[model samples]
Target: MIKQTFTSLAFLCFALITFNVNAQDFKDLDKSPMDAASFPTSNRVTEKVVKVIYSRPQLKGRMVESLTPHGKVWRTGANEATSITFYKDVTFGSTPVKAGTYSLFTIPGEKEWTFIINSDVDVWGAYSYNKNNDVARATGTVTEGNKSLEVFSIAFDKDGAMHLGWGTVRVSVPIK
Candidate 1:
């Protein structure tokens, strides 16, 4: 029991130190900080077969296209590269991907956004992103969100289209 208590106290001290160091890095930001999110796109069976994990970045009055850029490659989500996992082999946007996890990236465009599923699952932002590691690519058109979103969101439609929305823009890519 004493050992467990000591370990817990050590963990708490580490957490506090890490929080203090990271908080100083973002002190200039007035609001709309970056955050993480996760969800499953399918409810098909007892076990969940599809999942997405990503960081949500707030728009903070910035244009989505301006923030993400029109042609530059993006990590799709903030902080770490957005990742999606498939519990079973499934076709995504005309490409067959085996059951595994992959980093989700994109190139935002005015009319359409090019989506990418890459073999690199662990990465930060898009600093280390490489096109050679891309496993699949698909193009999806952009649409208006139902309402302006202050925080970026990634959700799956009932039909299995993964919807990515921020500001007034929304993009849907089919995952089957």
Candidate 2:
């Protein structure tokens, strides 16, 4: 009876430690900031566009499949699923993306990545993803990263170009 009790206690301790570790990971993400205005929020030289500036540190370590699963929609970021509001129609990899806000998600693969622009916004996560509302889909070639990225993030260049990159692969999406 004593042996069984000790084993149960050990198991409980291990579970608690594991839960705490995961909780800490999420806490670190929560501490990250979301500053949308500091970054270039507009590109008037070409056409008026609603620029989206976002960054999330948690995207670094979290496994895409474990946290966001395959064949599902993701809210791009933690709080609001990083959103981009466009004032004019734009093209995303040959697909005509209309003027509006869209949630971006990616289906990651070993060699290729499918970038999805979904109409749904304000979602909690990929749990409620709907494929029928996808506005555009683009395929980007993946390149190996020199170092593994713990968090996935995106940034725009000073020239008003979109860059989707992590680890080592950096895909550029020019604004027209």
Candidate 3:
């Protein structure tokens, strides 16, 4: 019993010391923080039709076009590719998509943006984006927002339209 007690005490002391040493390394915060957007748009609502998880990247004195770029597939957010989960089958823009989780990708254009719901999940970025894994593709109108946003954001409006905004650029797609 004495030997076991000493071993336990020593292990506890080592764990506490190791944890104290490692705690200092976690001082920095993620530059691009993760955020979520759900349909219903209210905390009071228990049920949700859709939800999106993504990281918000700040502009920080950078141009939106230069960061996202036109005619290229963007991850839709920073870090891991943006993921959207649907509770039920719904019409996304003009395309029908089943209830499931998917990685959201975007191809930005001058007048419109092509939003792709891909079966690929847990992707780091658009680097491994595959066209064959696309579940559905939809087009969203690109417009200029009245106010500029420093960080990339996503929200669902009251009309069930998903909006993506960053800098002065806004893109909208209807979901029903």
Candidate 4:
């Protein structure tokens, strides 16, 4: 009985120490937290047509133009470049793209934004962006929103239109 008790105590002590160390190793939330948006967002619709994973960066009292300068390639989000996956072949804006995952980048303009779907996947910021690897380029109309969004966000409407909004600027890209 004493041996069994000692074995149990030893195991309990080891478990406690392991749990304490593991609990401390957990990291806090990222400053620019990752987010995802999918078409057919309805819970009943298990089949997704398109999906985008990106990081949300807060405005933090900074201008949108300052964060994403005009006439320059932006990663489309914070941290890693935004990735967009299409479950099947579809027309994005006016450009036809095959069913695959691609890195999403954008060039901000005064009245429109050029949405670039690059073949490269799992890339960091646009530091290594190469225009030659572009799969498709589409034009997204930029419009002023009545309500300002503090954090950058991407969402898809029921009609499969992708909308990107930040600080009162809204860009809509149609998909069919």
Q: Pick the candidate with the highest lDDT.
A: 3
> TM-score for every candidate vs. truth?
0.76, 0.61, 0.88, 0.87
- Residues 1-176, candidate 2: write the lDDT tens digits: 99999999999999999998988774344554664521254443544465664546455555544644545554554555667777778777778888888777767655566778889877655667788988988776666656665565676667555666555555555554
Which runs of model 2 end up more than 4 angstroms from their true locations? Answer: 1-29, 35-50, 53-55, 59-73, 145-151, 157-161, 172-175
Of candidate 1, the 10-residue stretch with the lowest lDDT total is 35-44
On TM-score, who's better, 2 or 4? 4
Q: Which stretches of model 1 miss by more than 4 angstroms?
A: 1-46
- Compared with the true structure, all predictions reach lDDT values of 0.82, 0.64, 0.95, 0.94
Return the TM-score for candidate 4, rounded to 2 decimals: 0.87
lDDT of 1 at 55: 77
Best first by lDDT, ranked? 3, 4, 1, 2
| Global fold similarity of model 3 (TM-score) | 0.88
- Model 3 lDDT tens row, 99-166: 99999999998899999999999999999999999998899989999999999999999978999999
- Scored against the true structure, residue 15 in model 3 reaches a CA lDDT of 100
- Please report how far candidate 3 places residue 54 from its true position, in Å: 0.3
- Candidate number with greatest TM-score: 3
Report lDDT (Cα) of residue 80, candidate 3.
97
Q: What's the residue-level lDDT of 22 in candidate 3? A: 95
Q: Cα lDDT of model 4 overall?
A: 0.94
lDDT of candidate 1 over 1-176, digit per residue (tens): 99999999999999999999998784465343444333343334456557888877877777887879999999887888888888788778999889899998999999999999999978998889999998889999998977999888887766677788999899988888
